[model samples]
Target: MPSLSEVISCLSDYDPNALPVAQAQQIIRDVVTPVEAVEKVALRSALDRVLAHDIISPINVPQHDNSAMDGFAVRGADVGPDKAATLRIIATIHAGGGFDGEVQAGECVRIMTGAPMPQGCDTVVPQEFTQAAGEGEVTIPAGAVKTGDNRRLQGEDLKAGKPALAAGKILRPADLGLLASLGIAEVPVRRRLRVAFFSTGDELRSIGEPLDPGCVYDSNRYTLYGMLSRLGCEIIDMGVVKDDPATLSQAFRIACESADAVITSGGVSVGEADYTKQMMAELGDVTFWKIGMRPGRPMAFGKISSNGRNACLFGLPGNPVAVMVTFYFFARDALLRMMGAEENRLPLMRVASESPIRKKPGRTEYQRGIVATGADGVQRVRITGSQGSGILRSMSEANCIVVLHHDQDTVHAGDMVDVILFEGLV
Candidate 1:
């Protein structure tokens, strides 16, 4: 494994104090490595797991040329170009059944969808396009179907001896069905990543705890648990650690010992307590940075070691919204890499803005937005009421995040802006 310093040395323009969002992402990508462990899991249990090896198809996907509709399979030469031709229907073939005899000229076979094409038959005319002329006879109209029409050719979906799925893919529902189609009962996948997270503050209390003056219930840990669970990580919720040097140090050590990554929301920014930062510095090669991004700016990132075991650490801001934003933008990809998953960045779509948005040019801003189709039948986005880092309600009410790039200034009401949607059609 390459050290963080070695990775940083390779970058030409690296800054720890005032890091660009893109640069910070690149740095994290270069420093993190995938975990090297594999386990065989049943196909149903492998959903959301990263595939460890490429899966090659053992046989053609369709296995043989088959009918794609309920129709009469016949030789193309049997149907004339200018007039309808009547042919004797010799046999009927269902989905799992096959015909043994060859289909000769002036003869046809009634075939159901997915039935293997009989020998010497190349085209199928749908039952709706054909008429039962008499007993055991069907008439196919001229120009009903060309040769090879309505037939699913062998190996059309996936060819034998070719890769069906590549390594590092996070298996989804469709992937499971694809593997099932290839007769794959078990799959090799990387083990689930172990993540331990906590919150730090003297004024933070857990649920059911007595509320003291100036203390609020800690929601960061609960949010982290949900997010990590969605990513298929084994979570170790260390709860809220008190704002004390020894207690924080002990919590950090314990987290590093048991998990592949550690996350804490609080104590990394200026004006907060210094013990968390001081202890983090002593325990690891962590770098605290003020990222050029809205809602999430102050972040601490690096690897920390405890008793010969090391884990990646992400110190996010104390604000509720800021913690969620930093986790999604930075830590999400890094953790996916650690788990050996190769996923592309979520696509940002362009849509018109419903109202003018105030933004600065120096920092990237992610404002919560409500995307809706207006009376004009065009999709447009409007920002939520409050974009403050502490306003978690804004995030809940939003269906997407309106992204303002680092070089962009204020946006007009009708201008197109990029947005990342939280919900998808699938």
Candidate 2:
């Protein structure tokens, strides 16, 4: 296991005070390791679980050569490019049936879709292209389908002993169908990650508690719960912890001892009277960072140990919107790694802006925005009214987060900006 200091020492431009977003992401990836535990799960229960090993196809898909269309199976030599040919229809083959008799020259068989091709037949002409001549003969028009046009070859979909799905893939609906097609009853997958999270502050209260003059209901835990649930983690919601030194220390120790990763929102900023920072430093090798980003800035990342058991730690900002931003951009990938899953970062889309955006050049900004299609079919994005970190309503109303890069200046109207959609993240 590599210490956080050892990892940071290797970086050439390591600055904790104003670390770049990209640099912080890379550091997190380098310091964390994937879990090695595995479990066998039934196919129905394997959805959204990461595969522990590559799935090899046991049998060839489409085991035999079959017809892809309902038509007449005939020899390629029977049809010509310039002239029409008439053939006698000898047999009619349905799906899942085959012809045992040889098809002679000037002879064709009526074949349905998914039916195995008859012996000595290499092409299929659709019923619409051929006209019926007499009682059992059909006329093939010139320039009809070419040879081998409507036939599905054996093992085309999947060959025996070939890899069907790679390891680290998160199983989805289509994956389940593919596994069923290969007759796989169960699969090996990584066990779910155990995550323990809580919010810390004396001014925070639960939902049922009465609102005092300076206290407010704690909303960060609920948001964190929803996000962690979507990731398929075994969550341990530790609720709200006060700012007392002994209470905070006990919470950190218990969280690290019980879960694979510990996440907390609040008590990470500089010059705070609370003992959150001191307790964190005493517990393990943790570093506080003020990243060059908007909505989320103060954060702490490291490994903490208790009773010889250790877990990764992430201390996020206390504001409602800031907590979500920091988690999505930082802790999400780290947790996925701990679960032995592949890198599944949300993709950024470029869309035109509906109006000019005020921005500085040194820091990155994540402004909530709604992406919609214009009357001309072009997609454009406009910021949701105010982007304050505490205004959780804006985050709920917007469909995407407009990402302005660190070196980018003010964005003019009609300029293209990168955005990560909520549909993908949630």
Candidate 3:
């Protein structure tokens, strides 16, 4: 019998031969986490990247109270219901210009949208409501408009020294526009997570090469590279490597030395040519492997400290769909945690199923699905004909993934399932 300490080590150790998906996700979150560091990046290059620090507003948006309409800035007290109050449009104010004179009780200032409201003017009537008959005079309608109806108050959008953007938020297009409104020319963001990827197997070939009878072209790395780049990660596609320990050891060393994280496809299962797992074990400690799932059950994780830098590693399944799913479930979260992302889970949406679907009760499944609105304006989803891990075309056309968790034993035609939106991914 082994000693108690040896038994504890045995139980705690991550076995690439028998790790589950949840276990894998947890291990990744624990082993490789984020530490805040700043990188000065252009606004154009900061999309989808996590903010390393909070952004404060330097100037009050709209610096002063202004008109939201292009009619006239008037003293509302002087205008009566259904009464015509004639006033001299003392001055015209276009965008980027303002009225100079103060408005008397019955006077008005002709103003355009975004123009500063004249002094003593509190409301704006749209040009459509006022009839302009002369060079500088207009009639105010007797049907009195509400005060402040067409005015954008000073500092309404943002106040100086206010938190414009909270740290850890992922930047989107709207965020960029908001930052621009705050007059921010540059942002301090987390430097892109340097990611490296490759595929393995003696039975893999590059797309340009003639296909061998028993081999298939490698596509996982390309897909991984593209998706990671879209997520604002700097990717290094190391290409394909054969299923040999020596070559893998050298390649792994390079990836560990250079990238913040390394990803590979295939050669991680317990088979004769499964050299990646063993090679990784030799180079560094593999966190876990072997998630309980369909199609792509074999996965691997580890940390490698070599050369100049240390990196986290992931080994996805060989099949195309498996590789994509594994990345979403595993590496995506890992990258998020490493990037100081506020959201731990990816964005998900709920949709009702239009037709009955079959599923087993062992593990979770992500089926490619198309989402459309029914007559009631409710989103209904229908799964593609095949959800096989190799069905790349179906995955391409899908807009969502219908999630089937382990505890969900059955689903009916109208049953609701939580579908992860893949609109941007596709």
Candidate 4:
């Protein structure tokens, strides 16, 4: 792997201070490399796991031509376009059963959904489109179906010896079903990433500890735990490390030795106690950035080493909401890359704003929003009650985040604004 300096040298317009959000993301992408470890797991156990190798279909899906609907299978030539056609139902074919009997020109087969199509049949006219003419006869109305309609051709879903799933794909429920259809009992996937995180501050206390006069219980670690767990990472919670330089340095070393990444909330900003930045500089190549973004501005990102073992470090802001925002926008993608996941950015959908929003140019803003369908049936977004970085309730009440672009100014009521939903109706 190339050093962070070498990587940054390649980019002509690299600025640590006042870094653009896109530039910060691109820098992270260029620096991080995927972990190279593979394991074989059962199909059911591979959900959310990143695939290590391309999965080629061993056999065609639906080995034979099957019926897509519960209907009558007949020759397309027998069904005229302008006139109704009547045919005798010679046999019935149920799902998982084979119909070997041939259908003549004036004969049809009563086929259930997923049943193999008869030897000479090409199309299926759904049962609803046909009326029973007699005990063994049915009539298909004109313009009911056309040639090559409602027939699921053999290997239509996955052909034999073809790639079905590519490497780096994070398997979902549908992917598991696809594997089951191909009779894949096990799949090879990348090993889960191990992440170690802690909160640093003299005024921070852990749960169950008595609160001091000005100390507050640390919530960053718990939130980080939840976010990291949802991303399929094995988390090593280091608890709350004090603001002392010696103690913090030891924690960083231990974290680097045990995990692939280390995340710390607080102490990255230009405060009187610059021990975190000083210790980071002594240990590895890290950069402190004042990014051009709201809620999250002070951040530290780079690779750090301890006892010859190195791990990526993401030092986030001290504020609770700022930590969450920075993690979602910056650290999440880098961690996904390290875990060997090939995923695109979450899509931003445009929806009307329920009220005017106060925004300024030059810095991107991510406001917590409640998106819902109004009485008029149009989906609109309203900002949460308090948009403060310390107000954790804002994040809890929000179902989506309204993203205002860096170059965009204030937004008027009813204007289309881009939003990324947190809870989708899947």
lDDT of 4: 0.91
Q: Which pairs of residues clash in candidate 2, taking residues 3 or more apart in a chain or in different chains?
A: none
Candidate 1 residue lDDT tens string, 27-89: 888888899989999999999899999999999999999999999999988886788999999
Point out the worst 10-residue segment of candidate 1 by lDDT: 271-280
Query: How do the residues 250-326 of candidate 4 rate in per-residue lDDT, one tens digit apiece?
Result: 99999999999999999887773376678888989998998999888899999999898989999999999999999
lDDT of each: 0.91, 0.92, 0.80, 0.91
In terms of lDDT, the best-performing candidate is 2
- C-alpha lDDT of candidate 1 relative to the true structure: 0.91
User: In model 1, which runs have C-alpha deviations exceeding 4 angstroms?
Assistant: 424-426
- The C-alpha local distance difference test score for the whole of candidate 3 amounts to 0.80
> What is the lDDT, from 0 to 100, of the residue 181 in candidate 1?
99
| C-alpha TM-score for every candidate | 0.97, 0.96, 0.90, 0.96
- Taking all chains together, the TM-score of candidate 4 against the true structure is 0.96
lDDT, candidate 3, residue 175?
95
What's the residue-level lDDT of 218 in candidate 2? 100
| Ranking of all candidate structures by their lDDT, best first | 2, 4, 1, 3
Flag regions of model 2 displaced more than 4 Å: none
